[model samples]
Target: MQTEIIVAGFGGQGVLFAGQVLAYAAMDHGLHVTWIPSYGPEMRGGTANCTVIIADEEIGAPLVKHPKAVIALNRPSLDKYEPLVTAGGLLLVNASLIDRPVAREDVQAVYVPANEIAERLGDKRLTNMVMVGALLGATGVLEMNAVQESLKAHLPAKHHRLLPANYQALEEGAQIARETLAQAA
Candidate 1:
């Protein structure tokens, strides 16, 4: 089986990093994976996104017409990818940045206040991690431990001091998703 996910938002939102982390996790598990990043003309504060595909066998290509899942960190991304999620797929929205609600009933949409959650955790920059955690919580596509390990292996040494906070953000985001999903049950 294969899962294709797209992480999208403004450039500085760590979209590429988030996708890469997922790819790293897949690779660490011996799963075949591919990650492709797309950047807009403008850099930080501009549009940026990445597509990650994980499968049990060799991947044929990285291109996808409609992904199985999408993490939209901003309104523009939600607007552009909302209708592109395959039916019965997943859509994780950052409620802190997106004011509107998910319009697709065919997809399981989880809205997490990533920015607010990260801010509460002491760093708004950790929003991407929060969303990543939410996706794990909602779908279990990847194991939490693997992701944690991936972060530890790849995070720059200079930023290593923030590991505790980053881990906290992941748990907090996952908790939110668990609660939300429970309520909808």
Candidate 2:
């Protein structure tokens, strides 16, 4: 299987980190993976995005012009990448930050209130984790267990204490995505 995904948001939203986790998860599952990140000059509020490709065989390129799936964490991100998702692809939007609805009809759009959910979970930083979970749920590109394992492997030892919170955020996002899918069906 081959999956191309784009994750985008402002800096400090963990867009790059989310891509890293997804790439690591793909690697742990023995899949060929590539992750490419881009960001503006400003560190905190600048736009940041990453493209990740996971495949069962060798990957031809690291850049993704049109992705099969997208995780857009803000209105600007959604506006920028929503049109780039291929037809019949998946689009996971962070509803809490993006007030507008998706306009596409061909692709699956799963809206998760990532920021609000993360706030409820007591850590706003887990918003990206929530989006990651929704992406995994909507695309089935990676298992939750694989993502959890990836977190353990990629996160610094000093940050191990936050694993449980991240796990919770992931599960919450997955649940939201599943509910959206069910409603759509």
Give the best candidate by lDDT. 2
Relative to the true structure, how large is the alpha-carbon lDDT of every model?
Answer: 0.89, 0.91
Name the regions of candidate 1 deviating beyond 4 angstroms.
Answer: 39-45
Off by over 4 Å in 2: 39-45
Residue 38 displacement (Å), model 2: 2.0
Local accuracy of candidate 1 as per-residue lDDT tens digits, 1-185? 99999999998899999999999998988899999987455346588899999999889879697999999999999999998999999889999999999987888889899998899888899999999999888876789899899888888999899999988888887888888889878
Clashing pairs in 1: none
Q: Could you give candidate 2's per-residue lDDT for residues 40-92 as a string of tens digits?
A: 45335588999999999999988877899999988999998888899998999
Model 1: lDDT to the true structure = 0.89
